[model samples]
Target: MSLRFSDTVHGVDLPNNAMLPPFDDAWVTSWGAERRDGIYVSRPMTLQVFHTRLLEHAKCNNVTERFGVTRDTGAPAVSDGILWGVASWGIRKLCGTERFPAMFSYLASKSNLDFLTNGTQILMSDKRHYPYPDNLFNNRAETTPPSTTS
Candidate 1:
């Protein structure tokens, strides 16, 4: 699905090209930096929860392909999407549990910050394409964790 937004706020027509920025190479690089520097330290449990939530988000949105996951694997197949790289790195770190809430808050805040700061790009001309409404934001329904049977 294409990423595009167009809505009037207070009678002013919002630009149609205001779409969520694609998670590109620069984002990947920054993720690597965060991992190396331990800037956003996270515990193993928190990272697992984050990974699960991210995967569930992708699955619910039907955008698993974008993140490089497939039905057979049921795992992040590649580090193409923004969250994929972070999640993969977190799994590897397996850091001891501490400041779990802080880590989760950091991730959530960063995601929103990226969307607002990095995603918005204004051009002089008004030549932009806006995709039809896809109801992406509305599909964020709570996901039930996988059940285990012993």
Candidate 2:
């Protein structure tokens, strides 16, 4: 059976390029920041759920069926489409349970955040990504921890 928006995971199927609007809005919200505020924060509610939903869609949906590939004989079963690798990265964040150095690197690339920014690295450590609608707002980093450790 084909995966619907809700059946496979926690996602809301949306129009094409659904993620664009939300991302742009988020970027605009933090426009005044002198630093890289475009780098969003993810928490359990936002990031984890959003990430899971996207990954589930990827696994359930056939790569060939969505985006066709060509054989050595040049036979095409599917046509070219959006960048699936980037989708996979979003999936990884959803499935991830613990924070590691690599996760930081991955989100950095996906979000186009500067690697040199100390704030970005800190955000990666604190927040997590979720499975969300049309890849919009996948992460919600915890703004306040239970306690602060100095």
Each prediction's RMSD over C-alphas, in Å, is 17.1, 20.4
Please give, for residues 22-75, the per-residue lDDT of candidate 2 as tens digits: 221010001111212333343223211111111232333322211111111111
Best by lDDT: 1
Candidate 1 lDDT over 5-94, as tens digits, reads 556212111222223222223111112222335444432332121122333223333422212111112222222232222222222233
lDDT of 1: 0.26
List the pairs of residues colliding in candidate 1. Answer: none
Best model per TM-score: 1
TM-score of each: 0.22, 0.15
Candidate 2 residues lying further than 4 Å off, grouped into runs, are 1-17, 20-54, 57-80, 86-138, 141-150
What's each prediction's clash count?
0, 22
Candidate 2: residue 109 Cα off by (Å):
9.9
